[model samples]
Target: MASNWLLLRCRCGQSFGARQGTKPSCSRCGESSQITTTAVFTDPNTLTEAVANANLPSEISQQIENKLNEKKRKKLKSRDIANAGTIQRILKQSTDERGVLTLQSLRVCLDIEGVTEPSAEQIIGMAELQGVVHRAGEDEWKWLA
Candidate 1:
């Protein structure tokens, strides 16, 4: 199928996306110079993001990306610790007689704990990686201890 997105770079140093088969004027300068198509995509949201990222100066973009990534890693690390403790407490309260912790049970526990992020699958995967739990069935986990 034909791509619905076009990544256009203009002579004015502005980069943006447009519909395929069409040349859009530079978003930054109205420069009608040759528009170069650098990339194509089928998804409009991703295309929009690509255009925005392209418009950013390379050095500034790199710094912003690095800062965002670092903050995300830190936030996830702290939240994961808090969430792991909450999950373990929930498991003790909610694990089935066979010691299986179902995703549904995890979700309910998360809801009660007022935690909205780090989905149940994410928590389970983190626990599994930390050797705190293991998959016992298609949709359940069993405590390692």
Candidate 2:
């Protein structure tokens, strides 16, 4: 007996390959669709969009942003700034990395000391406001200071 192959549809109206005798939903909108083909793999981008657009908790978004940024570098990538939590984490990390971190140190940690990315200035500003670190002088800072 020939096994029926599985087919899936995306919300975007596109069709993709699925395994035989397997249950899978649309790769785009994530809606379940009728099987029309035997073997097909959904577009990777479509799957990515589907997962990203799904109903997710705010914390999940933060985690995603954190994972992406940490993968990139010591500084926040330009795209990472679009994510508020990533920016917040970067600012917090700036202060936390040192015992007596300073604005300059924050800037250095977030920008100059590593590869340049986005929101360097904004992070520096935010760190100044919320970071436990403080400026000790023209070139110095105290964490408790």
What lDDT tens digits, residue by residue, belong to model 2 across residues 35-113? 3443333444544344344424544777999988887754545543335565555555665444544455456555533
Tell me the TM-score of model 2.
0.27
The clash count for each model shown is 0, 4
Score candidate 2 by lDDT: 0.52
**Model 2 poorest 10 in a row by lDDT:** 34-43
Looking at model 2, the pairs that clash are 17-40, 17-41, 18-40, 100-143
* Candidate with best TM-score: 1
Cα error, candidate 2, residue 41 (Å): 11
Candidates in order have lDDT scores of: 0.79, 0.52
Candidate 1 lDDT: 0.79
- List where candidate 2 sits over 4 angstroms from the true fold: 1-7, 33-145
